[model samples]
Target: MTLFSPLHLREVTLPNRIGISPMCMYASQDGQVSDFHVAHLGRFALGGAGLVIAEATAVHPHGRISPFDTGLWSDEQVPGWRRVTALVAASGSVPGVQLGHAGRRAAVREPWRAGAPLDETDAAAGFAPWPLVAPSALPAGPGHAMPAELTARQIAHSVQDWHDAAVRAVSAGFRFIELHGAHGYLLHSFLSPVSNRRTDRYGGSAENRLRYPLEVVAAVRDAIGDGIPLSFRVSAVDGAEGGSGIEETVHIARRLAAAGVDLIDTSSGGITTDRSTDTRIRRGFAFHADFSRRIRDEAGVPTATVGLVVDAEQAERLLDHGDADMVLLGRQVLDDPNWPHHARIALGDDSHDSWDVRYGSALGPRARTLARLTASGETPLTRFSP
Candidate 1:
């Protein structure tokens, strides 16, 4: 099946379409990786994800959405990331990193905490939330501080940060890199009119709104050369009134595809305060399935459909039906990192012998039982035993 086929881009080859969605561990200290990151990511690779994307990594100190967010802004962070890439690659999964800048969403409290906007007191205590920068001075929430409007010079610098981060990602042994243009982050903020109300060249028209992000993608392509694949994760809509629509996203995706982006990781919403609509389609649901297909058909760029995509049949049918080229599992992968291994069995590949020898002895019987149960429409491996 196309879903299980190898995805070849440049010199980078994903062994399978299964990708570990970049999930923030929030376990870093001063933007440095700890043992938690190593173990957390390493296990997913071992569990058989073809592509393991490290969590959203901030390109600058203040660009972090929270104090615990990982960073690739400094040279010191590369060594910590190297440990992760090495392990993932050793497990045969191509390791990648998602480089991002949180923009107006930056410097907030960690999710486990209240996630309330951070204040000067927090910044002074070393968890300080600095004034976030965005295309407009929009605050992400009521209590969130209104961000300072980024000047052209600062915008240029921000683009440079993305370029630099791409270089650092390669140095850290990542074979693939994706720009975090999704989920109301920096690039998404610029794309959505609700968040970017600037009259400058970086805003106003759709072309203007896409200028900054396109420049960033171009810069990253220049830095990383043509050997590795670069992807862009985009929030296909703002979900607020007058927010960007799929027609606009298709235009952006077309340009990005021309500018050397390999795949478009399609996700949606997060520009405005409208979480109601966002919640309705939270699971592996692409808001504009037809639109995504149009992008792949017309623009000819491979797409990765994410958000609430659960189960092998749904993922396989997505590719089988021509909706997207790949399926990215986020929370589902978290729920079971070995989902791919199980999926391969369900699809009748007969490669059950490919399970890692370390775990193969036990997995053989377990895979048989799971596949048999799954055929009967029951899953007994919901909770794995250590």
Candidate 2:
């Protein structure tokens, strides 16, 4: 199928294969989305994204990566999300959100400020860092605060939190729900042995590691019900040495599918905060295609691949060659929200007919005007040419 082809997942049908990957904007206040999110997320739908997944929203207050990250932990957050989902749905695009708990990665500064651990200098600015928690008591890195290991009772509580957040996500009008289990987040921490040093049913062996994430899956599925599609993003490989590998992640994907996860959004790395111990995959074009293909084939589940998917031809090639069932773009779309519309032109839709009528109606004539100008050997700079 082509990149513009529809992908059916349970009861949801994405109009095309171009999905906007969840990228955190770090612009909220106390986990409440402001107008920035409405305009930020709404434009992608208008720009022709088939599936628009919101940023990694914390499932619990302590799960936030930064104090400014958005959240679904409280009912008050629902109205803001509802505004965004309604705008996206009006364009026939599937509105989705990636729910996550940052775990040891919680309480870091915004990436622009170097993602350093939040300290009292920020508390003076009224953004006090909170305690971080994880599967183990290990500190995330050199400058990060030591996290408290999650207790058995706390683990049970965390599962309920995910369930409650899923309920909130539905109330917020999100049609597709994706669990952010990748990039050393809470669920990924439990999956990789490097971070999960616990000895209970939640750690050690592979099966033990998968327990908590699977429990979350069941809880979210029950909350969202059978009709709504559920997706899980997995790291597929850990960044640190001796951490979980593709073999382990593939096994995890299989179990996730059986536990009601409808799709595997394949990604990798970020299990460690230290750049020294980091073994992240190279940022090549469509970096996660190989991982996605393997997870799709071996695990017997549909997959969406992300990372450096910059252009339409490259994205279409990924689907054409069976690299993935769908392609997700993050930085590329941020650079140009109408990248999908441009892609349709690049892939032979010269009429711009599929674009939002507001844009396409004007764009089509402009394209013809440009074409005519080009036919007359007139470039914008040609008037000054010798």
Candidate 3:
């Protein structure tokens, strides 16, 4: 398999394996996506991402990591997403959305402002800190507020919350839905031993810890139905002591597949907000390949690997070597929305056949001109060589 190869997940056939990783823009208002999100996401689709998954959208308003995070909790938010999905589909890319709950990690500032928990100083600025909920009553970090332990009744309600969000996602025109069970999020918190300190059926053993997230999976699947594809993103390692490991994640992947999840969006390290104890895999090219490879092979499920996958050859090699079924690009794609189209050129599609005609019609000729100039020894610095 190559980077440009098509991937069939259920009834959805991605024209290529490259996908835009769901990176939160934190630019929404009242959980509604704005014009900024439209241009931001649509550009990637127009640039040639086979699948464009929108950022981690909260299922509940309080589930938001920040006041600005997108939400699927209400119908009001669905119309905004519809505009985005329509644009992505027009550009021939499948639109997807990642459903998530921040858990105890909620009520924080954006990453630009140090991502600290909101305080009175911020509350005065119109962003009030909200209560947090988790598997146990614990704070995410030093300055974070302590979260209330979710009762059995609340957990059941939360499960339905996910179901309702998934239903909203479908209505919003997303063909694919991914559960963000990574990065210290509510779902990940429950899965990790470090975060889940509860004594009930939802906590103690590994099986118990997986309970809440699995219920969510079932709920989402029931909401979206058999025709739509469901993907689960997992923090393959908790990146903290006394937490689940790769082997445990592989087992989780197996269970997820059994629960009707079509793919595992393999990621890592969000189980703790404590950087002091962080042991996440280093961010290198295709860093999550090992985790994804193990899950795909051991659990016999399709997996997508992300993290620092910047180059065309690097992404292609991951697929060629069976590291993952697909590769998701985040920062790299953000840097150049047309990375997929550029990658096509790098991988021998020199005529810009894959790029949208709007771009290809111009870039096609530019390539020939540049090549001709190079053959004639006309480098940018050549004019000064004399």
lDDT of each: 0.84, 0.93, 0.93
Evaluation by TM-score, superior candidate among 1 and 3 = 3
Which portions of model 1 miss their true places by more than 4 Å? Answer: 120-125, 274-291, 365-386
Cα lDDT tens digits, model 3, 1-386, are 38888999888899999999999998988999999999999999999999999999999999999999999999999999999999999999999999999999999999999999999998999999998999998788777899999999999999999999999999999999999999999999999989999999999998999899899999999998888989999999989878899999999999989998999999999777777887877887778999999999999999999999999999999998889999999999889999998898889888787777888899889999999999998998987896
Cα-based TM-score, every candidate: 0.91, 0.98, 0.97
Model 2 is weakest, by summed lDDT over 10 consecutive residues, at 351-360
TM-score, predicted candidate 1 vs. hidden true structure: 0.91
lDDT of 1 at 361: 79
The regions of model 2 sitting more than 4 angstroms off are none
Best by lDDT: 2
Per-residue lDDT of candidate 2, residues 1-386 (tens digit): 39889999999999999999999999999899899999999999998999999999999999999999999999999999999999999988999999999999999899999999999999999989999999999877789888899999999999999999999999999999999999998999999988998898999888999999999999999999988999999998897987888988889999999999999999999898888888887888888899999999999999999999998899899998988999999999999999988899899888788788888899889999999999999999997999
Clashes of 1: 6
List clash counts for every candidate, in order.
6, 0, 2
Error of 1 at 34 (Å): 1.3
81-168 per-residue lDDT for model 1 (tens digits): 9999999999889999999898887877777777667887777788767768889988765677788999999999988998888899
Worst 10 residues of 3 by lDDT: 277-286
